[model samples]
Target: MTEQLSTTFNSLREAWLQHRPDERQRREDLLRLRSAFKASLPQMTEAISRDFGHRSAHESMLAEAMIVLKEIDHCLHKLKKWMKPQRRKAGWQFWPAKAEIRFVPLGVVGILSPWNYPVNLSLTPLISAIAAGNHVFLKPSEHTPHTNAYLTRLLHDCFPQNRVSIIQGGADIAAAFSSLPFDHLFFTGSTAVGKKVMAAAAKNLTPVTLELGGKSPALIAPDADLTKTVSRILTGKLFNAGQTCIAPDYVLLPENQLETFIAECQSQTAQRYNEANGQTDYTAIINESQYKRLTGLADDASIRGHKVIPLLSLNDTQKAENRHILPPMLVINPDDDSAIMQEEIFGPLLPVKTYRSYDEALRYIITRDRPLAFYIFSSSNEPVENALSNVVAGSVCINDTLYQFACANLPFGGVGMSGMGHYHGEEGFKTFSKVMPVLRKYNPAATDYLRPPYGRFADTLIRFLTK
Candidate 1:
């Protein structure tokens, strides 16, 4: 397996070295990929659903299909402009030199995508690499074989094997894939795995863009509307059963508004997800292990005497028979040291913490490891500005959640322990590109007189240039 991986990478590297795609070729490739992806939407949706045990069709369309399509469109529309060399000012010392920066392809790019939102995560980065005129080697999550199979077929049909290839396997293959020498490696998963990927890539001195998850917080100001704030929080949190990287891992609001927030959460959840009527609007946990881990977090909190409120009622038997669907719930102020609070909650369990003052809330967020996303719900500008100024995060959505990632123009990434690097829109293009600066020198250069050995003319020219 390792030998085969090496052989495939070598072939791709050689092929890319021989002939990189030009602007017209890249646009044509993107257009073909977009067409194939659009045509396969129905099958793609079904494959993702099968992989997740019971993924919502609408959610798959909105989060995966629609978002990827929009990204491709954004790239297609902006590729020409992005490809144009950017003119830069040359210093007086090099008076007759013209300078510009060219966006060039960086050989083969390796992509490691996660199972959560598998299609979107894989294809979005692939699109960026293609737009940047690089060959791609992708490895989708092993947990989603169905989706991976579909992706392999779709991508291969649109692009040649040397241009775009998808490899499928478990942890061993992922480790091996990360160790492969590529121009750049892009990974989307947990922070722990991200560290390992970075370390592996370090052996080759390869650059990496890690889109990792952390404990993102949603803060509600004292003057914010509880109804709207709770609704948006639940919407973002419960999307994909809180498996999103930027999902609201916890909530911090005023102490007096705790009860009101809880009430609003329950009301909004009931209205949005009508399980009693047999509407499968909600998504199930990805698999048995994930389901166990989520339940374990809640159990640990409950055993410690923290208030565990279930927004939707479901018995153990029902939860098991329904493919491990853990309903949305709140863990009110679990101890800061508890498992649920310490780790990223990639499930529907939201830990709600209260703050005595707005400053306290900002402090709580600022002190922790910078998160992937920070959501602030406030009507007044003062508290919003305070939070914005103090709390450092990968991205911020003032009154909403997850919308920041949907915007192609915005650069999406994390800080400190959360993760590093940005990818989306122009940032994505640049991330996958090598921005090379070029200086074209004319015959009548200003530095000709200053290049000689110790002489009066050289000294005078140097002095004048320095002055």
Candidate 2:
């Protein structure tokens, strides 16, 4: 394994040293990868489902494969234009000198992908690195063993391992990966683990794009359309069983409308998944640990006078083992110190907090460190604009959540506690690239001033230009 990894980096360094691929060659490579991904979507989806026990294929397509395909297509179409060296205006003293920024690939990149959206998060950034003309080393999360195995096989089949390889294992392997002094590192997981990754990368001073998850909140003002509000919030919350980094972790609503909003949300759940226990379309939590964590939050909240409403009517008597089938839950007016609010809730629990006014809601959302994503469910354009402008987050959706990430033109990432850097779209290429600015003075006409030995006119010109 060590030999394989060393050879991969050596080959990528060799590639960068020997030749810089032209725009056509870069595009051809991206298109080939894109086509390969399109052909393998079904197999990838099946593997993901197998790994998770019951991940929905439609969810996989919508949340992972389709988004990845869009990103690939977007990059392929725009890379040539993005690759063009940007000319910059120079000062009067440097009239003959031209300055430009060139987006150059940073050799071999290391990507440590989480299991939630293994295919999309793992392969999408790989596409960006490829588009940026860098070889990649992808380490898909080992928790999803089946998916990781398939990813390794398919990537080795489609692309040369030395160019793009998938390394697999648990924490030790992940730690080993973070130790490698790659040109850049891209990681997606919890903020706690993200900090560890950052620390590990610090040893090599490797720049990283940490796509960490946070407790993203969605606010609904008094005048908002409850129907549209509940529908969108539920989709974001329940998508991947609320495993998404940008999923609505909880909600803030006007106190008077709390009951109305909950009723509508419950109704929406029924319409989508119905009341059946095991037949619910939305999948289970990733594993027993996650399920226990979520249930513990619910149990803890219920004990603290917070109302717990499991959207589906599932009896506690239903055959329960380590299967971890906790249904989507709604916590009403949970205490500020509740466990759900203590950290990023990456499960099927959505806590609903009631606020009196827009300022109160805004304060609640902003009081925490800037989140990965913020959401507002309001028809009033003023409030939406105010929220978007005032609050700092990786991304925002005015009347919805999570869908903003689906747009390949948009940059997806977090700020502060949520995360540091961004990826996706043209930003993805920029994230994996080192945009070094180059300046050249080719005109001999300008050499007279530079070659002077303290002549009065030359000194005067230099002083004037410096001033």
lDDT of each: 0.92, 0.83
Pairs clashing within candidate 2: none
**How much does candidate 2 score in TM-score?**
0.94
Cα shift from native, residue 387, model 1 (Å):
0.9
Scanning candidate 1 in windows of ten residues, the lowest lDDT window is 314-323
Superposed Cα deviation of residue 79, candidate 2 (Å): 1.8
Model 1 lDDT tens row, 431-452? 9999999999998865665564
Which stretches of candidate 1 lie above 4 Å from their native place? 315-321
Q: Model 1, residue 371: what's the lDDT?
A: 96
Maximum-lDDT candidate: 1
Q: Write the per-residue lDDT of candidate 2 for residues 249-338, one digit (tens) a residue.
A: 989888998888889988888878754544436666777777788888999999998889989765444225327656788998889899
